[model samples]
Target: MPAIVGAVKVINVSASSIFHIGDVYAMAPKSSAKTYAGGGSFNTGSGIHIQLSDSHTYVNDNDKFDQTIIGT
Candidate 1:
């Protein structure tokens, strides 16, 4: 099977007006600790992980994901 895995670096997303689940955004200043999910992990096709080292402001409460942020 064809698969892709990478570490994505992100920054300055707090003020963005638009958000989408699968939308790709470029990184500024390059963060770290990105991981891609696989089929065996959860019987799923593909996935991505994004993590921030420091606290960031949210526009609203709805943006927060229900699951644990670190291990998701």
Candidate 2:
């Protein structure tokens, strides 16, 4: 089956909430990188988590976090 893209919107999590595994997020382009597709949240420590996609390295405070596409 074809993948379905979810609604695009900025991510708004509770103060202590964290994204779960298989959650997808979108990040705007930064520096020399283009728009990125990220997903799969993994908690590292101190309320910080990383996406499982290739754009993980480009994520930053300035980047926009939009959408939460579920499923593979």
Candidate 3:
């Protein structure tokens, strides 16, 4: 069986604006804890950017996944 891999990213706003403050949070299964890709709050002239990915090549065979993201 091949490993299940994927990635996700989110932002609070998607328009031409400035972010005075921003925050981000992400989490994954304990078994694949190391698979947590880099993600955090970023200030942008148009909006905030959050990037996340799953780099684990040995993930389980399951195709189901759960993720959480909090931003402000």
C-alpha lDDT values of all predictions: 0.44, 0.48, 0.41
Per-residue accuracy of model 2 over 1-72 as CA lDDT, tens digit each: 445666656569654345443434763332222464545544356866554445444556665645433331
Q: Encode model 3's per-residue lDDT on 1-72: one tens digit a residue.
A: 444545635477434333432342543323222233333533457666655564333446464545423231
Question: What is the TM-score of each predicted model, taking all chains together?
Answer: 0.17, 0.16, 0.15
**Model 1: per-residue Cα lDDT over 1-72, one tens digit each:** 444646656664654233333435553342234344433333435565645456443343454444443432
Q: Any idea what lDDT model 3 has? A: 0.41
**Model 1 Cα displacement at 33 (Å)?**
35
Error of 3 at 7 (Å): 35
Which residues of candidate 3, in runs, are more than 4 Å off? Answer: 1-18, 21-57, 70-72
Residue 37 displacement (Å), model 2: 46
- Local error of candidate 1 at residue 34 (angstroms): 37
Candidate 3, which ten residues in sequence have the lowest lDDT sum?
29-38
Q: Which regions of candidate 1 are displaced past 4 Å?
A: 1-5, 17-72
Give me the displacement of residue 50 in model 1, in angstroms.
52
Question: In candidate 2, which residue ranges exceed 4 Å CA deviation?
Answer: 1-3, 20-72
Backbone N/Cα/C clashes per model = 0, 0, 0
Which pairs of residues clash in candidate 1, taking residues 3 or more apart in a chain or in different chains? none
